[model samples]
Each structure stands twice: as structure tokens, then as C-alpha cells.
Target: MHTLAQLRAGQLAGIQRLQLSCGLTEFPPEIFDLADTLEILDLSDNALSTLPDDLPRLTRLRVIFCSANRFTVLPAVLGACPGLTMVGFKSNQIREVPAASLPPQLRWLILTDNRVEELPAAIGACTQLQKLMLAGNRLRALPPQLASCTRLELLRIAANQLEELPDWLLGMPRLSWLAYAGNPFSAADEQAADAATSIAGIPWERLQIGQKLGEGASGVIHQAVLQQTGGQQDVAIKLFKGAVTSDGLPRCEMTAFVNSGDHPNLIPVLGEVLGHPDGVHGCVMPLIDPGFGNLAGPPSLESCTRDTYPADKRFSVDELFGIACGIVSAARHLHQRGIMHGDLYGHNILHCGRGRSLLGDFGAASLFAPDGPHAAALQRLEVRAFGLLLEELMERCDLPAATQASLTALQAQCVSADVGARPSLEEAERLINSLRA
Candidate 1:
């Protein structure tokens, strides 16, 4: 409650918490002297451009909220504070983040809605980081060193200008939650909307709906057989519920599928169908029938934990590598055509036949635009997700020792936290081919 004119040096000594949400254009340098006991500071919704260089003197500080500020650069001195754990700098004007400026003990770093172009490789030094929010930035790539953050769990880097994702992101065993969309490569085309509607026009009466294949936040998928086609096809029909129709997600997915054309390793979009009175909308795809003696369907990495399976039965490395190669090839083709499959994971990939894989699910695809402001950020997120997927595949012990080593090394190169450190899809393809040979 201290007035701006009455604020003094010794007045803040006993204050453990401070909220300066009003009438403060700048933080008085004298405040940093309170480092002896101050634990929390809230300077949000202010006009401040930069933090005081001496502010890190507060050794006891634990959390700092500096959202909605005009900060273009992070204070170098803040990294000197050993006790700092959480830092919120969302909705700022930050343009770059040098690795040497981060606090070593930081656990949660939120920097959403800034103009950051890249992340410093030194970020991997912060092994304690668990939750990182880098959404709405201008990053083009990620540093490879990020794989060192073994404790990281939640990473949200949506809404940027990414072209490709690296392979190492899948290795983080603790990572669970991830969200990346609105990238140039993942952008939806205007023409794709009509195609989605057309694809949704498939006749349900002409096909037999079998078991449920999968479900997502948007809709459910089912395995079905078409009597006219004379063969079974894996159809993922998305019934737009209460709100998705208006959100343009269905149209986006449709556009991506229609525009992507066809590939052997990609699920062919046969057609789309809609239900009467807006009850449902969906598309038809080829069914990947499980051969005799094989499991009903491929299990997600999460579902294959040791507790879920008998000790004697385990996933094989060769199978996982085959899946990885197929996905990489599909992604390579998509990127070459100026498209980005926003979401890439084991669940989105389907094993069509022996050594054959198909990349499906265009619900999150977008067009690639390298000149846009967000291009780099989008690519980094994709790389991160790819890294995570590769890590999951390499975890299979049944994979041959030599094969596992080769795949692991390739994944490590792709998932590098530094976006620039990640290898191009073409380079990745060569690596995979070498292993195949």
C-alpha cells in the first residue's frame, strides 16, 4: 500500500510478498536490497521494459510474476539467484533468449507470447525443468541439448512457424502433455474444406462398422468393411459433436487429406460422409487388418508398460524401427509439399502390412510458410514431438543391440533442443537408409 513517493529502502525488509500492480512505471532499484527475506514478487500488468540488473540479489526469492510487461530481454542478473525456481514472463516483448542467461535451478519457465527466435543450447543444463511453455513465439529451431532435461513433463510450443520436427523429443520418459498447432506447415487450406465434406459423403449402409479403433478430443474412429469395395478398410469417421463443426477443425482435416493425395506409406483418403441433421461427419480409410497370430492392434507406448504385459512378452525393436522409418518418410514428403502434419506420434501411425506403414490423421495439418514470423517456432515444436516418438521406439529391448544403437543415435540428432541442430528430413532419410542397408 506504499505510495510511489513514500517508498523507501528499509520499508521492504520485512515484506515477504509484494504486489505492485498499480501506478508503477518502473521497479525502484532499491527493492533488490530486500533479497534477504523476500520470497514472492508480482509486477504484472505494468509498463516496465526491463528488470533491474541488481534485482537478483534477493537470495530468498522463490517465484516471480512479470507477465504483460514490455521486456525485450531477460535480465542477466536474475540467473545468479540460486533460490529462484519459477519465472513467468508471458506476454512480453522478448525477441531472443541466450543460454547463458537462464537460472540453473529453474524448474518451471513460462515464456509464452514473445518474439523469441531460438533457444540456447545451455538450457539442457537446467535438468530440473519439468514444465516449459514456449507457445506463440518466433523460434525457427530447437537446441539438441534439451534431451538432457530428463525430468521435463509438459511442453507447450504451439502457434509458430515450424517446418519439421526432430526425432529425439520422444526420448523424454517423463514427458506426457504436448500441444503444437498453428504452424505454417500445419496451416489448413481453403480448398480442403469442400474436399472434407465430399470425403464425408461415403455411404455407411454400404459398409459394416466393426470395433472402435481410436478416439480423440474431436471424434471417434472405427474399423469398417465396404461390401462394394470388396475389402475391409480402416475408417476413422469423426462425428462433429456440439462445437467442433464451427471451429473449422473438420474442414481443416478434410483439406489436408484431399490435398495430400496418396502414398503407399500413407492412409489413403477414400471418401467422406456426413450424418443427417448434423449428428456425424467422417472419412473412410483403408483398414490395416492384423495378420493371423498377430495382436488385434498396435499398442501405444503408454499402454505397453511392464505392468500391462506379461514379463515374457515385450515389444520388438525391429518392429518399432520399421514404424519410425515409415513415419519419417511420410513426414519428409509432406514437408516437401509445403505441408506440416501438426501432430505426429505412434498413435497417429498405422502398420498397414508387413514392413509397410501409413501416416494418417490430418486433423492438425497446415501449409508451410518460411517467410512468416512464426516459422521457426513451429519447426521447433515439431522437432520436439518427433524426438519424443523416436525415444519411445528405441525403448524396446527386443531391438537388436546394433540396430538399437544406430536408431538411438539418429533420434538423438533429430530431437536436439536447438532447432538448428536438428537434421533435415532428407538427412534423416539417408541415416535410416544406411541402417536398412
Candidate 2:
């Protein structure tokens, strides 16, 4: 949170990062003083509408964030920054993204909650791109040129106006995590609506709300007591914030969570919240054991799209194999019911630290017609995510030569370059179980 006063007084001369959000309406000329050292710049939560055309003067700048501002057009000068790779302009009024605005070395781009109608064909020039977030936009179609980004992985296009998923998107070899719910094509599906209504509702007055347990982009979880027919039951309540999250809408998440039925490695929703004073959307879930904890932390700035683990984090082959089995089984269960856990990351999994794991967080999950044209491709795309999870686990674990070879073999098959060539979740589960025998 660098202040304008400090920047102007030369107190922040050697700083590598700068953040000025105190109602900035224009770029401070003093910023040019740190051109040789500045690497990251954040001007979010401000009243800015434009940037200086000489922004490229910050030669070392590699990341920039200008979210929650008034920008209507992405500055073209951003493309001239030789070292800039990551850019974010979320929650702005950006309606136009000129082809020249995309950085040459771009790896990640976030444009969530914007009014973007289309992407430039020049996006193909960002062949190094890996992650793209375009949820809550007005996009009706994706350019075929996006196929040139062969290394791309995570993508979010939810709450958009797309009439159908792109055929090229289904075939992206490296694509793993994807959220496309709330689009024009799938929003009216009767199956999802039926699933949402099938779940029993628990009156809000019946809940004895307790301390907050945790929170994510879409909702907050809390310890609560539910009054039942014969007794009170301990539970965890998730009250959605009712905002367009990075993944999609809270309504979509609630629908997917309720639709995903009971599984050994999946948390089951007990019932939905009814008659809240504020009309808040929420659900009742069984309390998780206190012993359970997240397997890993969410991605950091440096990792970009991968989960981060504690420096001393380590797992034995047996433990990792057990975790793998549970996740694969849970994935199979979801796919069988036409759900795709768009976020199949370690950060979303809770483990008892002995191999037992629970997959939660349906904020990124999307439901598709089970027999739809892209069903197989969608499942396979999630397979790549699972495969990557296996890779992350393997990197932190110690395994005997033979056991390592076996698990690596299964992972290889799961992450095969040909989407069709990747083994189905059922097949992967079977192969993983074979290792135990």
C-alpha cells in the first residue's frame, strides 16, 4: 500500500512493488523515478480511467493489476512491456481489448466481471498463455485462434452468453480446469433445476448459528446446530454471498453441490437453507472432523496456476496412493452423474494426513448433460487436472523405485496429450487400486 506522499518524497526509491489505491485518477509522475527497480504495480480500487502511454518505462515491471477501476479500454502500452506477463483488470468496465493491448510474453490474463463481447484474434500471439479468466462477460463465441495456445491450462467462461462450448476447447490437450455454467446454452437445463429442488430445505429459524469456520470467494461456512425432528444435529452451514465469483454464480455452485450425491471422498449437503431474513442462499452440511485440514495452499503469485505446499511437506507412496484412490473414485462418481469438478486442486481437498481425503468446494463445478456431445471430452479434461494433482503429490513424496514407476505410469496415461487417449476416471481408479494388491 504505498502512499503518494512516500512515493513523491523519494521514500520508496528502491521498492520493487508499488500499490497506490487512495483515489488515484491519474498516474503519478513520481512513479517514473522507480523505473529501474519496480517489478509489480497495483492501482486497483481507484478512480482511474486511463494510464500514461509511457507505462513501458518501468522496464522491470512483470505484473500489473488495475482492477475495480473505470477503465473502458485496455491500455495498448501494456503490450510494449518487455517483461510483463501477468495482468488483471477484474471488475472494471472494460468493453474493448485492443489486439495491441496483449503482452507478448503473457501467461495469465484476468478480465472477470467486465463487459467484454469478444477477444482479439491477436490472442493467438500469446502462445505462452496458460490461464485465462473471462467469467461474467457478454461473450457469445470464442475465436478459433485460441486453439493456438497449446500450453493453456485453466479457463473460466461462466456466466457468459455462449450458446455452446467450442469444439476446439473440448480438444485442448492441456486444458484441465474449466467453468462454463450459467451460459445461455446450459442455463435452462431441467436436470440442474430438478436437482436443486430435490434437496430438502431446513428453515433458517431452526439453525443455531455458531462461529465462522471458513470462507471462499462465493460463500462463508460456519458451525451451526440444526433442530431436527427428535434432536438437534451439529452441522456446518454454507451461506452464499450471492455475487458473481471468479468461477461463476453462487446459484450454480449450490445446484452442483446438491446434485453431487453421497460419496466417501465427497462432502454431502444435508439440506438447503430456507426463509432467511435477508433471503440469503445457503445449505446445511454435516460438520467435518476437526482433524481434517487442507492438503495444500492455493496458488501463489509465483506458482500462478499450481497449488503450493509447505516447504517441509512430504508424503509416502502409500499415503499418496490412498489420496489418489479417494479423489479418483469421487471424480468417477461425479462424472457418472454428469458433474465436472472444475477445480480439482489439492487446495480444495481436505485430508486427515493419512491418505483419507474429502473433495469439497463446488464453486467451480459445472453440470453437463451426461450424454452430451462433449461429455467424454469434459471428463477427460478433468482427468488432466487429476493427473496434474498426482504430479504435485509425487513431487513431494518419497517412493520406492517400483512404486514410483507404477504410479508415474498411471499418471502418464491420465495426462496423455490426446484427450481421447486419457484413461477414464473408472479405469484410472481400477489401475490405482491394482497398486494396492
What digit string (tens of lDDT, one per residue) describes model 2 on residues 138-200? 999999999999889999999989998888898998999999998988876635556456878
How would you encode candidate 1's per-residue C-alpha lDDT over 104-218 as one tens digit per residue?
A: 8888787877888888888999998877777678777768799899877667566556664555664464554454445554544334334344443667677677788676534
Question: Backbone clash tally for model 1?
Answer: 49
Model 2: lDDT of residue 309: 95
Question: How many clashing residue pairs are found in candidate 2?
Answer: 0
Model 2 regions more than 4 Å off: 188-197, 227-231, 275-279
Q: What TM-score fits each model?
A: 0.51, 0.95
Whole-model lDDT per candidate:
0.64, 0.91
